[model samples]
Target: MQKKSGLRGIHAGWYAVVCVLVLGLVALVLYGSGAYDSWRDGRSLDQACDGALAQDGLTSALGSSHLKAEDGDDGSLAGCFVKTSPGTGRAVRVTLRWSTDGAPSGSLVWYNADTLGVREQAAPLGNGWSGVVRYDGTWQIMVALDCANQKNKALVAYGDLYGASSGTALTGLGRVTTETAKKAAAQHGCQVKAGKRLTRVSTARLGEPGTAKPLGQAQGSCVALRDVPGAQSGTPEIMEYPADPDAPQTNCYLATSAKKPGYGLYAYYGAAAKDFESVGFGHPGGDYVLATAPCPRSTHEAAFALYRLYDRDTGNYPVPHYSDSFARSALKAFAEHEAEQRGCGEVRIMSAP
Candidate 1:
């Protein structure tokens, strides 16, 4: 009888063990199927930034749909950052910032360094979007959308995409930024005429040793200085982007030879121009050769500057020479052409240094 009791107890124990295993499996299946939705990751893209951002452009760009978001607000600045979940082979981190007074001071400085210098090129985000896109080991974009109702307050978006290439970066980040901007505008009750949807962004070629072409055969904005006597000598090469009045800034680089030191000729508009003028030693018409124009369509004036290239190693000016008067003439031609495109009044060249 005792033996029989022992067998029965063994059967009961085994049954209890099986029941526990099955219950655990059922719980896991319920969670995976979202039956326990409350336990899911709460920080989703739709919930980030009070639902100001969307996953439309980011999913394909980052090659992953499993994303997480974190947002922050610091009175003057607000931002939302999105990234892929851990263990995803496709890694991406994108941050979008919103501000009424333009980008932060540090961002303006970085923009000047990245776009105006010879390191990277800046291209206009076309299709009526007043913004610029650039790439240098990563992608950077800044867009300014005017708000009619919110006078003196334009909705500006600054986006940075890491671990993504040019094609996907431009298309994906550009679309996402535009979408977010429009959404934010609507949510804030700002009357903004959003631009047409963007499928692609312009190409911004980075400066490299083999990319410089002869000044004699230069095209785009560099053509203004192609015939100058100083630029005609030696194997002077030019790195240039086509004139883009839609862009906040434009640039031209002149190199004595391939991979050698050079100088920069650039134009800044809107808040960037204001920032350029406010900083130390960056004032126009004094130490630097510059010109100003009244941009009627924009809230701020436009500035065109000719400045020395900073040494790659030391980050100090090597100060390439050409002739101030000749340079001024070429710059005037360049500025006038751009001003015409922007529908701006008189291009006022600054006094010689």
Candidate 2:
């Protein structure tokens, strides 16, 4: 199945954490060199959701008429996002599939808020799992199948989201998911066991918190990111190390809420060196919004700093700016704090590392 796609509570088992920490750093360095962004150019969003309404089994089964849909593939993801005619409020419907055929090991199969769990109701998708997740005013009905074709094995999931009041919400969506899973199973020649239900997942095991949550509580190395002055809280971004194992993770506490939209407070621990630009921010003619200083520790320290980018061309995020003074000040404050913690040098206009 194709579909796509953190740190901070990182204090226990120092040795194990360090190894993973280094790996995480290596990944971030590559990311800094521009290996981030999982979405690659591909079929237009329309192509991704090619048969959304007309060809989908769920719509007719659910008695959803006059519904509208849009779908597409973004390198790693492919699916349709739908809303009823005159879609309004939080009510919506979505169908997503990872476009990638070969997902690397350790890739996540389910994510987003209000995680899904299994409940017994019916068995339609022969040989997989069925679950449901309800949150706010919306709910998602999900199904996954283990389709193996002699050699390669793939796990594919199908889901539907809708208001709880829809008549066939349960029965129809479940049947549609089962039908879709059957088609998918046959496509991959994998067996599906009818009526097999997943064990209930505990509420205690809510979805894993990642960058989408508040940066303050999101995980990080050394110290968690505290609230920044004059900034609305935004999600922290965790750059994972793609090297075989996790190590040296880079936890970026974004102050995107910084009266400006692109300010981010990046912290990375586990062995790493500072690049000249990061190390040379305060000097004449260096980056205007970027700055960095070495974290005091020889092993685990926050040495990297960056002023996150907001592409005006995409008009994606609100345009943001951080004065050279503010950026430098933040870096200086961060470095001084690190020195005190690691018993290193007094913070000054730090020299190039």
Report, for every candidate in turn, its global Cα lDDT versus the true structure.
0.66, 0.36
**Per-residue CA lDDT of candidate 1, range 155-250, in tens?**
676667767465765688888877777787778776776677888775547366566788877777677777666664632878777665667777
Once fitted onto the true fold, the runs of candidate 1 whose alpha carbons sit more than 4 angstroms away are 1-28, 32-43, 74-77, 87-102, 111-117, 149-152, 164-166, 202-204, 227-229, 259-261, 278-287, 313-322, 351-353
Which has the greatest TM-score? 1
Give the per-residue lDDT digits (tens) of candidate 2, residues 60-156: 3344543444552333223555454444432233343421243312112221110011111111222234333323333344443333333223233
Candidate 2 lDDT (Cα, 0 to 1): 0.36
Q: Model 1 clash pairs?
A: none
Task: Give me candidate 1's TM-score against the actual structure.
Answer: 0.77
* True-vs-predicted CA distance for residue 98, candidate 1, Å: 6.3
